[model samples]
Target: MGEVEIRPPRPEEYAVAGEVTVLAYQADGHLADGVGYDATLRDVARRVEAAEVLVAVDRAGDVVGTVTIVQPGSEYAEISRPGELEFRMLAVAPSARGRGIGDALVGAVFDRARALGLRRVVLSSLDRMHSAHRLYERLGFARLAERDWRPFPHVMLIAYQIDV
Candidate 1:
């Protein structure tokens, strides 16, 4: 219930961010299938090295959320095209949900996109993440159904875009 800071995770905070991401996903039943996605969620270091990894920290300086922003041609980018910025792996701590941390982190992404002179920002979310979809809609993102994709069998990823 205090001010939350959105910034890049420090070297020592990478592991903390990774743990928070994993915990958030597991708490939301996103990892219920015992799939290999848990490892991906916990690989904050890899994401940090490959893209910009942003973390939301509480007033006490505890990392409560994380998101990875990928540039147009970054290896982590999936559905983004030229002139668009893409973000992925957005996760907020279970205890910190509904505290505006996710919104703040996403706002940071939009800020970064504008700062880079990008025309749009794009992201993909699991179909079942209704709360996140609501947040994206509230932030002015519109679903791009034609761009929706399935990276794995039986797993559909929905795409959303917002012109910045």
Candidate 2:
């Protein structure tokens, strides 16, 4: 383990986005549904370069953790409330957990939000991700609500919001 690299991703790196997503949520039997096309990956890289996404890669260049912060107008932001930035995805690859990477990613979001003049942030997570709940709480993200919605049946989900 050398110096960990935290930086904007390149367009070619989007392929790893799909792989990482699949790996991160594999415990729940989640798989990619053909949604991560080339365009999506390119957009992800663009966002990464714009400070809209924070990705943590190991010294050898594998993406271990990733977080996306969306401004009020970004597509993934469904929260209609005012002055809110949606923390779209905060995923730390299973192999990289327990190393405080999640904590560092959230800290990066905090600094980013302050720099962008955003005061609030929110994200959705599955209820089964109990460890994630603990991590968010430890980082001062409080539970605002929980609901069941989207891609399948019996998928209980939670919404966490925080003022940064």
Candidate 3:
């Protein structure tokens, strides 16, 4: 693996980030329900209009991972309250799995939360994403089972939180 930088993506890289996010989720079988969530996953530009979009870029300057950091009242925030930050759409390219890019990207979220003077960060993930659950646990996120929700009939999103 090459050196990876976790930072806000350039405007020109939005499409690449969106595609990487969509493809990553697809490869992980998170898109099998045919609920049209891919449209949201592919809208990096839209997400950037409301929240911070961070990308993991390799030494070659290719975006291999992406995540959205949502402020408490932002359009992408679903389970966060005042003084709490939320993250959404975490995705690492299939080819870049196991290279720690996801960790770096999520670490950047913590950094952003601290920068914003927030102490708590929350996120929702697909229940079937066992590997992601492990990563969240390793990063100190505890399961927020009471906050689990279903945005659609075919999808149930489990919640997690960590205090930074």
User: Top lDDT: which candidate number?
Assistant: 3
Task: Write model 3 residue lDDT over 107-138, tens digit each, in one string.
Answer: 88998999999999999999999889999999
For model 2, name the residue pairs that clash: none
- Candidate number with the higher lDDT (1 or 2): 1
For model 1, state the Cα shift of residue 30 in Å.
Answer: 1.0
TM-score, cand. 3 vs. native: 0.96
Please provide, for model 1 over 1-164, each residue's C-alpha lDDT reduced to its tens digit, 9 standing for 90 to 100: 25798999998998899999999888877776656898988888889888999999998999999999998788899999999999999999999898899999999999999999999999999898888899999999999999999888778899999999
TM-score against truth, every candidate: 0.96, 0.77, 0.96
Listing every candidate in turn, what is its Cα RMSD in Å to the true structure after a full C-alpha superposition?
Answer: 1.4, 4.0, 1.3
TM-score of candidate 2 against the unseen true structure: 0.77
TM-score winner, 2 or 3 = 3
lDDT of 1 at 46: 89
- Residue runs of model 2 more than 4 Å from their true location after superposition: 1-3, 28-51, 146-154
Which window of ten consecutive residues has the lowest lDDT sum in model 2? 29-38
Tens digits of per-residue lDDT for model 2 on 1-164? Answer: 23356665566766685456556666444333444432443356555654367678887788887777777656655452567667756677888887888887787777777887888877777677777889989888888775234444544557888998
lDDT against true structure, model 2: 0.68
Ranking the candidates on TM-score from highest down gives: 3, 1, 2
C-alpha local distance difference test of each model: 0.91, 0.68, 0.92
